[model samples]
Target: MDLNQILAQLETANDEEIKSLLQQYNRENSHTFSFEKRKKACAKLCQSVLTVLGRQVQPSCQKTCLETLRILSRDKSVLAPVATRKGILGEDTQSEEEERVVVEALKCLCNVVYNSPAAQQVSVDVQLANGLCASLRNAREWHHEVGLFTLRLLFLLSALIPDLRGSLRREWRAVRLLREVLEHTLDVRWVGPYEAARPDPQALPMPAEDNERAMEVLKALFNLTLSDPGGEDDHQFRLIAALLRHLLMLKTETEEKQRKHTGDKSIQNRF
Candidate 1:
């Protein structure tokens, strides 16, 4: 469809239809759209919506459309301008509306990594880390949530990048940094009507669930390296070996616990 037709649809279509159309447009036309075209389209579409709807309530359908823009960002054609958008970059002048776009963009980026074929083909783990690092480095105080969400998603995507030499060092450090930041932001509580807003200090905490997820990412990275066993990448091999040792230690503890639990169950049965 022509640009006019597409823009018209974006303005008036039902939420589901709008989402579908946006995705289709992003996927099919991304390669073909000129740089100027993609830039203008993104800026215009995002601006128009923010003007009309504001940011308080993000409709599910609009969420999908925003995600489609994120998918589009995978293309250099689309990514450069969006990343460099006056609003997305410098923190000094970032408004809440701009921050909303950044957050929505990250949500889309996460969805792409977790659910899209594009992520599989695009080395999402590395690229996602880079994107989030940039966001965290650039975020303003009001947009701290955006940085937090990006960090959370990076923590998840770490599961998919295979371990490489010196990989553990960087990966673990990143997780540690994220945990520290989450801890620093720790005012969210689980009581009362704010239950949904409660922070899982465990997953985002040191010596807690965050450590577990970090271990998971480490294991996944190690597995990826092991799966392709070739002439050894010495540093990777050493890192993997270290992680394996740590895992074995945990496994021993797990087995002992299971044995104890089983024995407790047998005693109950006799009673």
Candidate 2:
């Protein structure tokens, strides 16, 4: 299909057509389509799709557009928009859907970082973290799965790059935003009526395992920021103290809940 047809398909097409358009876009222009190029195109098309969907009477088209962005986010190219000065992924200049795409793209980049070393090599962790911080608060209506995924990304990121942690320590907003989300994860309100609302916390179902992983990531980030002997004299002692306190509380809460449940079962058995 021609470019106009492709763009048209992207805006109005069903799932299959959207996928096909992406595939065709990639296949035909794979070599020439640099990450920046794809990002620009995605940004432009994403804006158009959102504009069109926004006017529609139905919600499905808007949802489909969001879903398309979610899928496109898997490509590293798509995530680059967030890191740009224009803040396409950020709340600074973009519309809601545009920002949503950027958030999804960041999550995708984090997954790529975990799964592939090459992608991480191409990114500067501090820049990516800055982008992520910008997205977190703005996406209050974000899907819970996206929230959970973003949290996991934060965990992995804080672990993978120590330098980023140092930058984050100095960057109060980034640190505060992350702490807020960490607090949210601990909130009962975060748990909803259905299984879907809760973040699986566990890569497995066992809470301890998930918490353990979370601890590892946090510890890594902390060490990067506060544990470097040559780093800084201040070493962010206050921030580290707060993080340590939070970690201990989380552990204590988890243990207490498990113990209470186990005690209840034992009492029932004795009866």
Candidate 3:
């Protein structure tokens, strides 16, 4: 169906129709669309999707709406303003109802943050990083997808909004958490007195979950240390850098190795 048909159907669409229309993106995303198409889709469907989410829909339907928005958010132009104005990024990211919904929302959020430089400025204005940090702190335990996406969002904020790094480090002490997460996720047992001694591992099977989370934490730390290390962070930087060194030394995943683990575990996680 075309955009107009999709929008028209969405207007009166019940749970299944809404899901079917939204699910189109699952395949469409694998191909590229023009800017005009994505912009048009975002302009027309942002409110449509949000309205569906606001209704007392079934958890399954709400999940689809959020997932669709997450996919569409790659447009990052029209969706950014509409999403921000709707208070999407500024709102409590952890959904009250369902964990999957929260994960989808966070993915949508990461897209908006990563794809739009304008969104970065808007996020800084709305103190989006502060909100993300608060949520990250509240999540003392890793809720897998939720925690992973939260770290990814924070990493995007740190990398995209250059001005926000110092505050993330000093104001939020975000570096400490990044350090802790990287260490815990990678089973990086520091050998020496402090982080000055980095992880040195031989053969390790990086769990899919740990691999993704550690990558995000590393990215955030790398972004924070882009400049000369501040006096307060010199030691921490050394430790994080050591972790990076260890990751780099990790043996490449052979083609056979990659083929072995090419299962549907990640696909199952979406639901």
Candidate 4:
């Protein structure tokens, strides 16, 4: 079915039918549906997913809807509907078994904001930075399955919207939260004897399983401070500088880590 017909079906379709129709669209034309074809219907199609989300339908069905959006978002022109939609990037997403639905939503957000300045702005207007920060609030409840995409989108926002960096730092305490998450995810902690902070590493390459999440945090930190006019004594600067001391202490088989690390050993090279 075309976009309009399928949307009409969504108004009355059963749970299984919702999933089947969404999946069929995703399979057949969510991609091939073309930008001009979807331009007018994009908002309706996006709302259809949200409408499905509003119902007490199966999580699988919600995921199908989100997955379809994720595919449709490949066309940046059609994302205004998605960009203006609040909660699309927020933390209230349904966290079912494995939090599949939540991950799917983040993936959609990543697709929406990865290159669209318009979507990025709307995401900021909706205060999604706070929502993304909420995802890391409780370490025990942290969604490990959703880690990469969450941090990735957060990084994109911080990078794409220069104006948002300050809010993310102050309003959300994002600097501290990101630091805590990096420590927790990497299982690293520094004890006693503090070392002065230093410059960030040029590259943070490591095994995908080992460093992907850490890399995401590093990339976000770079953007968060990208245009910082602050000096060394600045609070965000200090905290990250302190983090620099420990980040360098990590034992990595890669020379890039060793050469660029911020621990004591690098202090000698600093001067």
Top candidate on lDDT is: 4
Candidate 2 global lDDT: 0.47
Q: CA lDDT of 87 in candidate 1?
A: 21
* Displacement of the residue 230 alpha carbon in candidate 1, Å: 24
Worst 10 residues of 3 by lDDT: 262-271
Q: TM-scores, in order shown?
A: 0.36, 0.42, 0.77, 0.74
TM-score (C-alpha, index-matched) for candidate 1? 0.36
By lDDT, highest first, what's the ranking? 4, 3, 2, 1
- The candidate 4 region of ten consecutive residues with least summed lDDT is 262-271
For model 1, residues 1-271, the per-residue Cα lDDT tens digits are 5555667776666656666766666676646534455676755654443332332334554455565555554444434323323323221122234556557755555544554444533533334455554544443343454654565556545555544223433543343343234323332232432122333424422333333333334333433333333344443444333333322223212454434323333212211
| Model 4 global lDDT (CA atoms, 0 to 1) | 0.69
Quick one: best TM-score, which candidate? 3
In candidate 2, stretches whose alpha carbon ends up further than 4 angstroms from where it belongs are 1-16, 19-106, 116-118, 136-143, 184-271
Candidate 3 at residue 29, lDDT?
Answer: 60
Cα-based lDDT at residue 35, candidate 4:
65
Comparing 1 and 3 on TM-score, the stronger one: 3
For each of the candidates, give the backbone clash count.
1, 0, 0, 1
Per-residue lDDT tens digits of candidate 3, residues 1-271?
5777888888988998888888885556635433564586666687777777767787777778777666666665557444564546422433547888778778878887777777677778778778777776665575899988898889889887788998988898788767777766666666674543443446655666666676667667767766654687777766666665555444434544344333323311221
Stretches of candidate 1 off by over 4 Å are: 1-97, 123-126, 134-144, 164-168, 187-271
Instruction: Write candidate 4's Cα lDDT for 18-59 as tens digits.
Output: 999888888886536356656778667876776677667787
Output the better candidate (2/4) by TM-score. Answer: 4
